[model samples]
Structures are given as C-alpha cells and as structure tokens.
Target: MFDGPSSRREFMKAAVAVGGASALSACMSRAEEPIPKGTDDPSSLPERQHAWNDVLVHDDAGNVEGPRHQLLLYVNLDHDGPPTEDDRRVLESALTTLDRAYERSHEGLVYSIAYSPAYFDRFDESLPDDLDLPEPRSLAPFEDPEFDRQDALLHLGSTRADALLEAEEALTGDRDTANTVTMESPLTDVLAVDSRRTGFVGAGMPAERQDVAGIPDSKPVPEQSPLFMGFKAGFAQNQATEDYVTLQDGPFAGGTTKHVANIRQRLDDWYVEQDFEDRVAEMFSPRHAAEGLVDGVGDNLGDSSGLTPDIIESIEEQAKQYGRVGHAQKAARANRDEEGNVRVLRRHFESTDDDVASLHFPSLQTGISVFEEVREAMNGTDLTSNPAIRQRVNNGILEYIFVRRRGNFLVPPRRLRSFPTPTGE
Candidate 1:
C-alpha cells in the first residue's frame, strides 16, 4: 500500500510539480494500487464540464474533498486565424482519449478546458451578449499583476500523483497510451504548450512541503489543515452551486466563466507574530474567535464557514469595535445575489510550486463581473474609511498575500470545448 519513508512520499508530491517523463516514471515505481480506468462512451459525460463536485469525494462532515494533485497547461495555438477542421479533430481526439482512459473522479482524473478573451479576439465574430467575460485588470489599488493572455488553459486533477503525471505525459505526446487506452492524438499536435503549473492540497500535504520560501522554519502548519493557513475554506454552504454559476441564456448555456489568480503568501508573521485568536480574527472574524466557534483547522464548523447573515451584516460594527474584519465576512458582502444565494464557486488549492508558498485561486461564476465584485469587497476598501482599517492592517488576510497574476477564461460546454468561436457555432 505505497508505504514508505515520509520523505519518499514528499518526494512523490514534488515530482508532480517537476513533471516530465522522468518524474512520471519515478512516481509510477511507487504506485501500489491499480489506477482505475474510464468509460468508453465520451458522449455520456456531464454537460457542464465544471460539474465535478458530484464525482469528488467528501469528508465525514460532507464537505467536498478536492483532488490532491493538480496540473494546469497553458497553451497557445500555433496558427493565429481560426483553427482548421483538422486542428479541431486532432484536439477532440486527444481529449476523447483522456475521457476513455480515466473516469471523471478523483481516483481517476477530472479535467476542464477554458478559453481566454485574447483567444476569441482572433475570430471576426463576438461572444454571446449574455456572457460578461472581460479582460482581467488590477482589482486592488495597491497591486499590479501580469495578466495571462494565453489562448487556452487546461486543468487536470487527480488524487493519485502518478495518475496526474502520467496524464500530462500523454497529453504532451511523451507517452504512447494512458491507462492502456491508445492515444491516437496529442494536444501538443495542435497547441503549443507555453507553460505548465502544478500543485497539491489536503491534510498533511502543506505540512510536508512547508520547507519553502514563504513559510517560517518553525513548521507551524497544522496536520489537519488542508491549506497553508490554519483553517479550512470552500465550505459547501459558502459556495455557489454548480447550476447557479452556469450560463442559462447563451448558446454556451451549460458553460461558465472562470477567473484564476496566483496569490503568493508570506506567512512568517502569520506563524511568529500572531497568536491563534488574532489569526482567527484576521482569517475568519473577531466574533468567531471571541465566541470560540472554531477548533483546530476549523473542522468543528462543519460544511459552512459559519458566516451567517448576522455575522456578515455585523462587519461594519465589528470592524469599529474589534479594529478588524474577517476575510470571509468582507467578501460575503458582495458574494450573495439579490435572492441571498452565493454567487461564485471558489475551488482554490495550495501550491509549493517554484519552492514558494502560493495559492491558485480559481473561482467559477456566470460572469467575470461577479468575481471582480466579490474580490473588491475582499479588498475591504470601503472599510478603510475608518482609521483602524487600512489596505493591509486589520483589513483581512491581504497583509500576508500578494497577487502575482490574473486571468479570465470562458469554459464552454462539453460539446464545444474543442475550439469554440464567440457565437458558440
């Protein structure tokens, strides 16, 4: 059962980050369990490509447990003008190979492909009127970030480290077959891979990889915390449902828009200068800390982050009395719709890529404007009117995180995922 030294397991996780044929080979040598195979009928898959929660595993408390390993392939088309029919066929066949080789689950592999605004700019037509995907811009006044304008983005996830690496090799033509399914076409045949980003998440993972640039040597990451921060996030009640984020009126009716941000975290102060209660106040709310509502890693809170209407509405008062506001409380202001339903479905995961502590924040919504509004609220600019709150101090977790890059993409429906035009034709 893949048992080995803790160092060996940690090395396997690092191999996913440093992905290649060599890394995949090294990782496969340690696999004890047989990797599961997928169905042959690709047409039977779900319509919405982002509909992954049903396939993912859940904790005893019922919160969706995300895949442990993740890989993002950023690629641009070789030829500029709209892709040829041959290009589409090659891309479709490569993607179909993946579908046939692995089940759409954490144990197998779950993936999605998205297109950028720059990608649609090549076409003479425009996207549907109902879609509100705009070019990404600096959300916070204090920060400037490089925008990712690559033609397309492909996200792959799996609980097995070996499965994740092997999939990468297959997509890039480095392997003959995946899960014993012959790969007739490779994505690299039509698209040029610009860059590859990899990451891991779950209990004990952050702790094992804590010997990185941003974290302190004290090794303070809790064994139960899924993230580098000592708390759980993406509570089921706190997130928008998959249907809520899907496009309803456009030709891409089953599709959604995605916004991804790379946030670099410097947690020396989070571990050394701040105490548990104070950290809770910044990450959650002062009321949560004062009420002793959160246990270690916030597992006691269950499926929700405990941000009720009362807690969210009390942000202004709490900021005035406690001299601080929680990150979730601030964002919850603009996160809900007029019907009081959540707006964005955040599927963020932690990363030790480049030997630095960072978070790859991917939020799915019907429109990019919704994500921008929620992030602006997270900035707590409105709270900064008070003397106690500023851009960084007592506002939220912004003090410890830096926004490095931002990108917005349109995740078309499964049928049109190959090379969809703006009109969905």
Candidate 2:
C-alpha cells in the first residue's frame, strides 16, 4: 500500500503492519492458513475443542519478481527428504507475495480464510488463485475486512526466531516443544490508537450500517472482492500435471516445465473446488440489498411483523457477521502470504469431501424459504413453539436438497458438481 518497499527486510516488516502478506511470496493469499490451536504439533488432529482458524498467505507477483518468499513446501517428492533450503526459499517468496497483496492501494487490507489441514506440508497443491499460472504473484492471505483490522505486519524476517519456532512447531507439533513467540498489537499500550489513527475506519461506522457505498451491487462481492480475485487467478491459471511435472525443455532459463505442470494441474483442481464457496457467498448477497442489511440495522425499525424486508435484512446481517467476526483470525491468516502458498502446496481439504456439510444444493432454497416462513410465523405471535409451520417447511424440502445451518431453505446450485454424481463416472 505504501510506496514499494526499498528492501526485503523493510518490506517484510511493513507488510505485516498492513494486513499480513500477499498471496504471492512467502506469505498467504486471501486464503487463510488453517491454524488448529491447542496442540503444539500441527500434524496431529485432536478432538474438536480448541479453536481452528484458517490463516494462510500467498504470493501474487509472478516468479520474475525479484522479491519473493520462494516457498519450497516439500522436503522430498518422495516422502523421505527433509525440508531443503529450496523449500525455505519458496516459502519466503510466498510470504513476500502475500504481503504485497495485503498492502494494496485499494481494498486497504483484509483477511481470507478456509478450512486447511493442521499440517503445512499437507496444504492443497493449488496455485493461490487456483489457476495453472506460470508463476504466481503474492497477495495477502486474509479474506475478511474485520480480521485485517486486527492483524498487522508479520515481520517474518525480524521475528526470525519466531518464524523458526513456528517451523519447529510445524515440524513436530510436539507438546514438549510448545514454546512460541508472537508480536504484541500496535493498538496495545505502545500508543493508544483512536479512530483518528485509522483513517476512513469509522467514517461510516454509526451510519456505516446503511452505507455500503463501497460494497458492490453484485451479490457477494466475490468478483469485486480482492479475496475472490486472488483466489480465482490462483485457481484459474494453475494447471495440473502428472506427479512429476515436466514441461518440454524450453529456453526459459532455469524454468523446469515439469515442476510447473505438476503443481499447475493440482492447483487447477483446487481452485475449482475453492470457487464453490465463493459462488455460494455471492448467491446469498447477490446485490447491495444484502449489503444494505447492515445499513438496515442502523435504520429505524417500523414494525414487528418481521416481513420480507426485515427478515432478509436479518439474514444479510448474519451473513455479514460471518465475513466480519465468525472467522476473523482465520480470514486474517488467509490474507497473508505465508498462508497463501500453504494452500498452493497443500491439497487435503473438505472442499473435495462427501460429507453432509458438503451436500450443497436446492435444499438451501427450502432453508431460506423456511427461515422466512418462520419469521412470518413469529410475526405478532410467540413462535417459540410454532411446530406446525416448522414441520410444514421441513416437509416442504426434498431430503436431497441442501440447506444452510439454522436456515430453512435450499441452497442454489452454481454448477453440475453440486449434484451427487459419482467420481470418474
């Protein structure tokens, strides 16, 4: 966001201050690197209890870009090699790219997050944007604006010790080596930062609910959303190749077509899966109308009937909450560079799962309709036990149809994949 950094170290420090790293370099993209806390070891999965946040980084800038995090996610293509210097270089490059995206002139800085595995090595092997990109640039890893507000310069270089510690944490996830280090917030006692310090932050706070002026008329702001852009580009450009990605021996100097192709193929598949969520996000917030739900919150309530507008507004408000707080920390990590590449290197996420939660379809429509009906049933009445309407709505839906949590509607299908077709059919 500020003038291009003069030095790598300086840029690294500044990038953290903004919204972490870009999706390109040794940073995370708009995708959050999954942070499964409560365990010192990242590889082991514990029963759900501790919080899980997807905090990832990406490098948006292409490989030609001199300043890169160079994240080498693998120790050996074969499961036995230890992490090589090349691995560190690739990771560092990825971090730098993620920071750059976070430091954009527009979009200020925000965080993006998704469900990533506990281990970095197991990150989905997709380009940050999901494209078979020639070489990815870095963008911030976060996807939500709220988390971006709280996160700051990762300063991986300065916190050399901490980065190493995180690496150690990554290596073993062992409780015996649970010691860690992290930066204190700038908002801390260092110097109290009021709204004034945060230019344009509260300019629309009180009236902010009603003023989604910056919000696009397009439903979920995915295309317009920086998070969407970074991911789309990453996914779209990434091409998948055989296990050993090899391109024809070209004259691209040091360019091994093989590695590029292998990673690209996987990235392409990963990006497609990631887009599933983005498309859904857009469906619910198709226009500024949902965006205006926040605005509606600040507006004067006229009745208690809980009519269409009110209920819709409530839904929008709740959806916005998901973007704002529910996944703040995770989104912030997604906005960083380190987190972005992690997605590129890793490839084991629920995005490709067959669980009930993965069953997204027309049932969402039923859910939404049911939700509205519930609101209508509650209109001027104590709907605490309105089982008739509740059951009516439930019966209205097809079991195969997918609905959102607590929502009584069917989800819209964005593509054929939404159907329960068998693999390789």
- Which candidate number maximizes TM-score? 1
Overall lDDT per candidate, in order of appearance: 0.91, 0.21
Query: Clashes in model 1: which pairs?
Result: none
**What are the clash counts of all predictions, listed in order?**
0, 177
Model 2 poorest 10 in a row by lDDT: 256-265
On a 0 to 100 scale, what is the lDDT of residue 24 in model 2? 18
Structural similarity to truth (TM-score) of each candidate: 0.98, 0.19
| RMSD value for candidate 2 | 22.2
Write the residue-wise lDDT of candidate 2 on 193-236 in tens digits. 11111011011111211113222223322222222111111221
